[model samples]
Target: MPTSNEAVKLQHDAGAAPTAAEAVRAIDGIAPTTGTARQVADGVWWIRLPVAAGPGHVNVYALQDRDGIVLVDTGTNAPQTLQALTEALCILEPNHGTIRRVVVTHHHPDHIGLAGWFAERGAEIVATRGTLAVAHRMLHDKTLSRTPEEIDFAVLAGMKDLELAAFIRRPKRRYADGVAMLPNATSVIADGETLQIGKRCWTAIVGNGHAVDHLTLCSNDGLAITGDQILPGMSTNLNVPADQPDLDPISAWRDTCRRIGEHIDERSVCLPGHHTPFTGIAIRSRQMAASQEAVVSRLLEHLQRPRTAIDCLAAIYRRTLSLAERAFLFPEAVGYMNHLANRGEIVGLRRGKTMVWQKQRRPRGDTIRREASPAISRPYNFSSEVDESR
Candidate 1:
């Protein structure tokens, strides 16, 4: 018989995968309806809309201005998503002409896909320098592109090619940095700067990790447009792309989360880019911190078994992932693993063309105990078992 502590540990150690119902429940709860807007504070509204064949919807925020509305984050470039946003805006302001500016929290397609459409209608677009560059790269640079062949290589390198292709093809148009060339636009907003939109003022705080130069807009009305920085349901993916192989997203993301937590008050309502508005900034910040910490813990556990980064990724993701998903998974797993390796909790060594990780001998027994147990080895099968059973 196991002690209560041991039982709890076993339960935790079991690594029970989330059922499809649980996943759907988690996602469905965050996004109650497509294109529905929820008022979180005075003159502030959160909106969710479906994107192209993705896990969940993308969230955008609208701040009512005395003259017009300041929109933060446009949905994906799909016609339906655009139509949903248009309808929601019409409901909020009645007169769509009142939308003064469109500020993108980041350059991700889900956040900026419809920015050009809004810009065509006279909303100013803004983002960080790095974000703007990446957005341009995403749109214009097709030469150095990661084609299906590259995806297949990634698959052989340990990823699912089909999913990777789906992820890559989602973005429609990418915008260049700075204010878009819209006739009725104002200017590009940058870090440590403030902009007055509608009846409120917002400050742009730029940080990196999830995306290069991700911006979180904080308003005096106790509202923060967190974009994908802090999601309510799932952890945000942090990766080091083969194109930008030198990027260290884990450190950047950790620092960004800490900064956001420090600046915003605990009671502030977060208008994320993918979920309903929620309160308790401090609590969410702690949760975000813990989530990343959990990833590090998972990485360390895999290291004890002397697995390569590819092996660790399979262990962490635990299913046949789409090529796109595998692309997202591998770099994220390696990044967190590298972060822990840098902290001396684990060690990574290059064996031929692969990087294998292992635990470092630490002084404290508690430190060893703090590291999570190894993952249960399993084959990759991305299909939802719960969905099949149902």
Candidate 2:
């Protein structure tokens, strides 16, 4: 059985392949308790912060600068996170002074949540332009309503009638709830830009498919502060964009994995946004890309009959999804559907207010051979289980 954190990551990827045993080796066997700091490298400390829900903890790094510290990826804006961060900072203050700068890896609520709080304390918030724009919008926007595009996308995912009405009426989760505040001014960093954080000069590598322009810092000494783009033990989620419903993020994600793999070697120690520090980054990145390919391949086979994205869940998932899992995994299913459609392997047919997908018929001379998947029997007629009408 996987641990809670590993289970959460599996759910995030909608049941992607398990982490390869030899791909990554954890540097630290166990993580430090909340409010405590663990030194991972010279002038670099790992601080785990408590998360109210999901994964349970997020890892932030403190780099010792000449005058103070440069913190990367602040935890959520919750009280427990703030308390833990305060204690961790106090623990590092004797050697690192105070936090002079904060480098946001992404605009996710968990990573950038406390950025505003730090900015208020005179810490320079540095992030990519895409990240800053999205973070600012999510932090400040309070109004939540399903746009016409969103509703249409939901319908295409097989939601309609009472179910669609209920979904529309459901209170949208607010990103502001996790974030403290947004700073009026932010220092924007670009991809491939060399940053002088502390003593080591690091290059910023921007990746997509997880978040818009997610930043990962790589030092010449082979230490990488990889955010969610390249997690060690499990695959990250590639959610379909809400605004661009037809956009395919899986392709971007695969390209990113390849690029990161080429950039970082096996000897590099990677400090991810979650999970313990690990090595064999090249292998892990390849594993992630291959795992996603397997998912897409499996999804292709499951498209033998006309199905909705919601109905297709029965085909890909290893087990039944919980309520919370369903809410998050819905977008992932849509992502897979879009990927297939974009590849010309499937076509969506409008069925009333809903859209169903069927495998695209290819020419006899232009057939695409599919890899053989393990034989597993699952009942296709899972109307009771999917319950799209609910």
Candidate 3:
């Protein structure tokens, strides 16, 4: 149910436990705009910037404070993108000079694209160490080649020859190309740290699974600037790339969602990176968690017999895959498999150039569940329809 942006995304967001209606309204009470600023809160303005990747747009928020304008997230680094931001700010504050602070929710290309530009102009960019570290590392490093690694992973995951050839022959330096320019964060904001942007005090709530460390800032009063951590209706991607093949974004994402739902006040209005900025975060959070768990259950059912990630794609996703869709689906396929493997719910066996996953085949009728820390542990109930004869 992720829209085009999240649907095409191989990622998605959630908030604390709130009641959600299918038809949620935008806080600004305006339709989507390419490059215009509309006031969404008492002192915060919402600006949408079109990104080339994923959903083609990112929502940039500008908060007015006594010192200057504080931005929750900045769009990419293109001339037009920068110009749009300039126009919005000029109109918001005719005498604006400096962007007092730019708090990045994560280190993605679209989000961090303009941070460097702002930072160079005396803006103090604030983000977690993970965001700051990754931005600096990916920005300066050039050889962004992952062909060899990806080819291996694809083959092992059961990609078809035509698809494999297309995937490998295509561009490989995409980790950088996915966004504009990644700007490094100057101030490393830690989780639970209270930052005084203007008159309001915002606490940093660091999350993960989507990005290693996603930052969601919650105002002391009741508002939140949640980057991609929690979109109103979409779920963030938790795909595990080959570099960190064993990592479990699923568990990490679950833990983060539950924590936010428990901590953030029920009445908070969160400003997300995409989709309409709306309330009902608490229900949306539950929706996301349930959606992810549903995927896990589907994967389990598909594993009645030994299967590879590619085999379970049809079960996890309801749509057909185009080459572009593969970019999102492949990682998602592997992520679910890896999550099962991590929890000992399944095991993998190598076959020639590929690997196949099979149910771990637990003892008699006992319902199996993932055993993790209190932050992320969840039970997985198997359907009675599953054939144990395999």
- The top-ranked prediction according to TM-score is 2
Roughly what TM-score does model 2 have, to 2 decimal places?
A: 0.87
Candidate 1 lDDT tens digits, 1-390: 001122222222233233312222221243435556666667777787776633446778777777778888887777788788877876877753477777787777778777777778766677677766766666665454456554543443343346545655655222332223322333566777888876667888887777877899887777778887776545566665555443456566666766676567856777777655667655554455554555456666666777756667645654555444444457666666655554557766655544566888666533332222121111112123211321
* Per-candidate TM-score against the hidden true structure: 0.74, 0.87, 0.84
lDDT of 1: 0.60
- Evaluated at residue 97, the lDDT of candidate 2 is 93
Specify the highest-lDDT model's number.
Answer: 2
Higher-ranked by lDDT: 2 or 3: 2
lDDT of model number 3: 0.70
Q: Which residue window of length 10 is worst by lDDT in model 3? A: 381-390
Which residue ranges in model 2 land beyond 4 Å of their true spot?
1-19, 322-324, 350-353, 363-390
